[model samples]
Target: MDSLATTLLSTNLPPTDLQRDSVRQLILNYQKDVLDLRSQYRGRTSPLDVMARREHALQSIAAWKVVLSPVRRLPFEILGEIFVFCVVPSLRSRSTSADDPREPPILMSHVCALWRNVALNTPRLWSDLIFLFSKSLPKRGTVPILEDLIHPSTPHALRTYIDSGAFSVSDAPDILQQLIAIPEFASRVQTLHLKMGTRHLEDLLYDPPPVFLHLETLRLDICIGRRQEFVGRILKFLDSPTLRRLTIRCTYWEDAFCISLAPHFPWAQLVNLDLDVELKAAELVRILTQCVNLRQCGLFSLPDHKPRRYFEICTLPTLETLVIKGWEHTYWLFEIFRFPNLTLLDLVLGKWPTEALQVTPTFTLTHLALHCTYDDTEDGLALVLRFLAQSPMIESLQLNDIHGIGLIEGLTYAPSDNPVLLPRLEILWISIASWGDAAETVLRDGGEGLVQMIESRLHPDLRPSCAPAFAELWEFGFKCWKPKFSVSVQERLANLEEDGVLTWWE
Candidate 1:
């Protein structure tokens, strides 16, 4: 056995058939010998030391056999790729420290000598770095340890996230400076998220301004207030030719400042933009007119105030997704702009506008989500149904905080000779905020209507023969503040969900 092991270790080529047979026979012989020894000791009381020696020998053989696994023959590059897949992309920037064993990079290094060497050499494993600066500050030796973990010569782009939680530049200026001063750290940054105040931004934007050559995504969360000029300067300093996605969120409301600073951004070059600052109707139009290349845009708040003067219609031909939260006066928006290529519209409204639906142009929308804070009115439901009737291409619909049994009944398929509503609909999610007795009654009746509507869409034989081959509903979600579904209804829904006809969640 010793000679055979030495021969196998000396060869770099694949084992021959004879050598393979020899190895298998040797393993079988060893197992037979072990079984014989166990049979000999079956009824006898063996000494503790002898028993321990036998167990240790068996464990040692098993451990040594693991070295002969086919995985051991994998090239370093293939092994490194497997290790890279183990690193979760979402959790990459959540690694706060170099020594966090829970993180994949650190955990892989602790497995074995080969894994440690491969993990340290693979630049992708250590590219994402997160630094949390607090009032206590990072220890003196922390940066040096992090520097040692990251490969010095690897050219991989880094995704960096720095959250200055309650820490000002005066508290720990050296930490941020030291982190960026790391060799080739700034130039290689592909994505950056900074949750700091204006003071930190001011300090970071120095005389020459930092240059991020490969930056594609940048998210800034300014938690404190500062002068409008300083905000403009920060925006100007952070602009990069490679940036395509940008998000700026200010804790304090800066409606006017955002409008004034809008042109400072390279809006024509941006593909995605999100602003948390409130914007009036005219200001929103002014900003959208410049975002010519934007595909996805989000406005955090749209105040109810009307535009001061008449402006030409703003058209966004490239925009596909629009998300507006805490908005009112929806008519002002639909009246001022046209989204010819818009496919998704998500709105969180303070009040449902019946006039906006009337003026809104017909869109080939595929997804629509409407969340209203107030209770649904008959006029609102009628207007919504009218709006949906025109959008025959809609595939997914979500209604939240609405209690409209009439809307559900309207959506139910009728046997009479009438046109179908949303024939292409595949997903429906409705959430009702039931409060009083009247609201509960509405919720109960709406639940029944929802079931009937789903069944009509799911079962093809139940549909009228003249009806077009509509897309089957694949998902149905119903939520209420109070549970009002009868047991029979619940069982039927459960059986449908169990059979995977459509996903049902409440």
Candidate 2:
């Protein structure tokens, strides 16, 4: 039987009729034998006997798979690259627990001896550090863990985020020494993010900031202490020629403090800046004027702080995206800048004045987003509608508010007065959160308003002209916190969604 099986296995040509009949007989006999074996096992007194046999078979298959795995054939260099991609960027700057099961570098090393060796040798895999201090600074015990996480031989630059805000300078001395103890750690930092208290920052600023020659991105969420007097300019102290992206958020106890940037700060190389701290309008424009190659800027102007001069128009030829928040007059701010190539504008304002729309620059805008606390007043809705009508170039619109009800009302109410609003608009995203007892009112009002808007823009007979309001709209998104819309309204939206004209989300 074995000889016949080997002969059949070796043969490439079709078997003769006699040989086919012999092979079929052999196969039937083999199947019968297997069935008999199964029956014998089924009659055993214990189920463990069957399970043991199954486990043995599975183990054999698993062993064979491990031996034949395609990944095992990859060269160490390629395998190391795959291992590097598995690591999260934050882990490179912070200290990770030795027993952490979720840490990719540690997890990958534990898979097998070969993988452990490759991970240990790969310098880039251990290059990112993320440290989140909850109550105290990292201690002496963490030093060895940090040393083991990075490749000693490779001078790979590190990306790090160190949050030592929970500790004061007095309590963090040991950990601070442990961090800068390694000369390579300081020199190799390419991306640095610090969320530390004022004492620590002052102490850090005392020494000219670490010479992060390779640094490209920096974010500082400095928590202000009682100290208001500055020993030196924080921005000017840090020097990184390659730095391009910077975000600074200053928090003082409970209040937000104004962050002042030094004149000689690395404005020339910066391409992106997001400042959550308050700044005087004139100071903002002056800082921006020096950022000649700036591509994106997000600023939160000081509340109720009037600008030094309103007539000066800041020219940012390279600016393409701008986000302004907490500004009273969105239009006045727009007039203060000449954005010839600006394509995207995001406004989180307390008011959207219609006067701003009339004076807004002539450049075409492709995307516009508005977030403010609005009421059910007709004026609130009218201004938004008028704003949309004046800005004929907008293709995408997003509106959100605390009540969520007024947004849809504003959108629906606008088209009744201005039938030609947003003729070129293609995408609309509306998000409404529950407003306690007014949740139902929001749903009812917002639902009716949405239905009216859709019908006016979509239904052929209801549309006023060949150029329908939002005629080019191919996407509509509605998000309601407490979704309790009428059945009729829901059905209409569902039908439109089914036709692939809109989508509804709850």
Candidate 3:
């Protein structure tokens, strides 16, 4: 017989410590006892004794092997990454990775001695700690589901959310209870996202977790309740020195500035701040003054105030972009006397100036976006046309208006015959401007005809007699309202990359 031992080894999984001594000893004993029994029955007279001994040895081996191989060991780093993969948003009754049938590292224990040692020493393999509590559980039955898959050295990042939409405090107590019981849990959360109903916000504000240290991105979506307390708690949490992005939506308070934040607090390091609120003029101004390093800011539902000539030179001025919506022109447009470095300005007008105001921007404004409710009259449009024709640096402009500039009105050519303005403007938008409204006044014809006229005037052989589809006269803005930083821009940016206009990494 061609070594029955070789056939047996091929049929079974390698032996692990759990089955090491036992399986090895059984195999060895079978070799000797069965051979002896066979030898005694050499004449084939006592075949029963040999057959019985072989059967007993095989039975012992199978019984010992079954229970021996369930858990596995892995290298510290490999196990760390593996455990990280297991963590995710939790739901009730089922595991977060139930859909992923890939055998978890847990199977390594069933392999052999070498594999078990690797699986046991890896700290990262045991760090994902999750508690899943759901309303579907039996009335009197409660079980705490916990999992920890963390490396002792690697910092942890956790994200948890409670859809208190359908949950009552009585039903979703596990979320808060777990948090309160384990204070260390907050320290491990580097990226925190909490979205819950109005009822639980009160509890958070009263004795909230100080979870801001070392935080990088914070997104909070809470239903309105006890607005002042909620706002205060937010300011309290912002004491974090490491915060980079802050997003708050759907104002829960009567006014944006009622809750005060410490200006000197190390919270001003944030790069992005988005506020959706109806704030008093002073309060809005307060934010602009304090967060001098803020790179991006969005404000909606602005306060209605007289355009005051407030020109206090900002001390820590590095602002690059400002977007103001629901603007009540009761405030002065040129009053923004100190944006020496501002590159882009987006204003949504609720009201307009009583008259066309001659304005000279201090900085080289490259892009300007206007959401207009009022149309600049012939003279008003003339003032705007003159400003654009003079700006040597502006390259793009977007104007969204409800009313239209008059036809055959606001005419001021640069140099009579070759009078084409906004030479640098590459992209033009007339989202709200009607061709019929401004006939020969703005541009001789509608935008299309005007573009041709502008191109004809571009120094005869600037590009060796090459004419573009149209001239870069009026690159206008459109009211294409959509979510911020959405997927739509991804395609737009991709096209720009193909055109070689912008570097991808930059």
Candidate 4:
């Protein structure tokens, strides 16, 4: 009997704490209370043990009460708001996973039950969907998963991202129709990103829902089997007057997809247009004339043409900012035709001397960037100095993928035949990706001496003149493009810029 009492009282606890289960805990406490009485009656416990037993006996009645329990309540609404900021993509950066094997964000929903519920409930969260169907689905398969994800009961704020490849065209028609069939959701979709390469997606878009009427942004990336038919149907579907932002990327070269007007394109209502197509000087120029209300544009790499025929006469009258990724140097050296209200320009050089800078209301160019590839940094700088000499009123400049100040190549800085210095140049930044002889050559060829001469030649007593100086400098690059960034108006070109790092003031 005493042995039974001793055995019941024995509690060999593990080193680690165990989570408390209310039911099991109550049972253990009750057993300990009954065992304590048996041990005391048998007189088998010491005074200390007896006192510890006394404590439990006193606390047991209340300890076993139903009051000990966790309160079950839902998470706060603000917790969902935090999740929104958690998925914000960088405004200027987007990593491509179309070709490469990259993971998508859908898996985030599978992280936890609560998170999945929250993510599913937050319709805006699922709006940026990126899925790649690499494997086949069951015969009665894929439809259910997709339907449930975008059903009418789904939060109507869902945006759409449907990318099925060339082989998926048959299934695409079904999928797209299903998507279009969702009446109320169709109208809520603001951005429709459809990229089906090697496949004809236009056929699937046959009965596009009025959802497109409310869509303000559209992106089509294609490696079409039939380029003309593909483009025709695409343009046909673009009957949306409210479509403000359009981005189209075709497998064909830049010129292959030059601009064609439906008379409605330049409705003086369009705001942003990004074209990645094959283009020539004339084709590019004619297309520019159609974008009367275009405020921002990104032109991805164009083939180089000689004799400066096309771009020489191109005009961008209402363009506020322009981004061109191509051989900027090859652009005809004649002159820019027109940039009446342009204040921001990001010129990603492809070929050099292809176009020239025709000066306009010159002082209006406040934000300028020359991302070139020529090693003759001085030669290019000389060309620009000459270019600026003609314009004379740039506010800030950023140079990427190019060597800084060619003043030192034992060459003269802005040849003295009436030089032109930036009188209002308040911010300057020079970015170099490949660290090579550009730096060594300067040091070896008395680069410091040359810089001193140039600085001395500029307004020496130049204070920070109502503007910032060496305001900002840093690095920026895209994809596998060589990583490039640097900043030194220090011993090189002081009295040169504004007050932001990789950023400029005014």
TM-score versus the correct structure, for each prediction: 0.76, 0.70, 0.55, 0.63
lDDT of 3 by residue, 254-347 (tens): 3334434344544467776766654556655666666767766656655667225564544435655666776646234345425556666677
Q: Model 1 off-target regions past 4 Å?
A: 1-30, 42-46, 91-95, 98-103, 134-138, 145-153, 168-175, 253-262, 279-283, 349-353, 404-420, 435-450, 453-506
Order by TM-score, highest first:
1, 2, 4, 3
lDDT of 4 by residue, 57-76 (tens): 65654443322322112353
Candidate 2, residue 209: lDDT? 57
lDDT of 2: 0.59
Best by TM-score: 1
- With a 3 Å backbone cut-off (N, CA, C), the pairs that clash in candidate 2 are 91-128, 91-129, 92-128, 92-129, 93-128, 93-129, 93-130, 94-129, 94-130, 94-131
Error of 3 at 155 (Å): 4.1
Q: What tens digits encode model 2's per-residue C-alpha lDDT throughout 1-506?
A: 56654554433223445766675565555455556657778788876766666555555444333433455557888888987775654443446533245666778877766777888788887666665555543343445666665453257887766666455434343344455556677677777777777666566555545666677888877776544333126666656788899887777775554556675676868898878766656666677778889888877654454376655677778876777776555555666768777766777645656566655653466677677556654466565555555566765566566343454454545445335445555455555443444345435654454545643532224323221122111123234322233455457546646853332111
| Better lDDT candidate (1, 3) | 1
**Which candidate leads the pack in lDDT?**
1
lDDT ranking, best first: 1, 2, 4, 3
Candidate 4 matches the true fold with a TM-score of 0.63
**lDDT score, candidate 4:** 0.51
Q: What local distance difference test score does each model get?
A: 0.63, 0.59, 0.48, 0.51
Worst 10 residues of 4 by lDDT: 477-486
Worst 10 residues of 3 by lDDT: 477-486
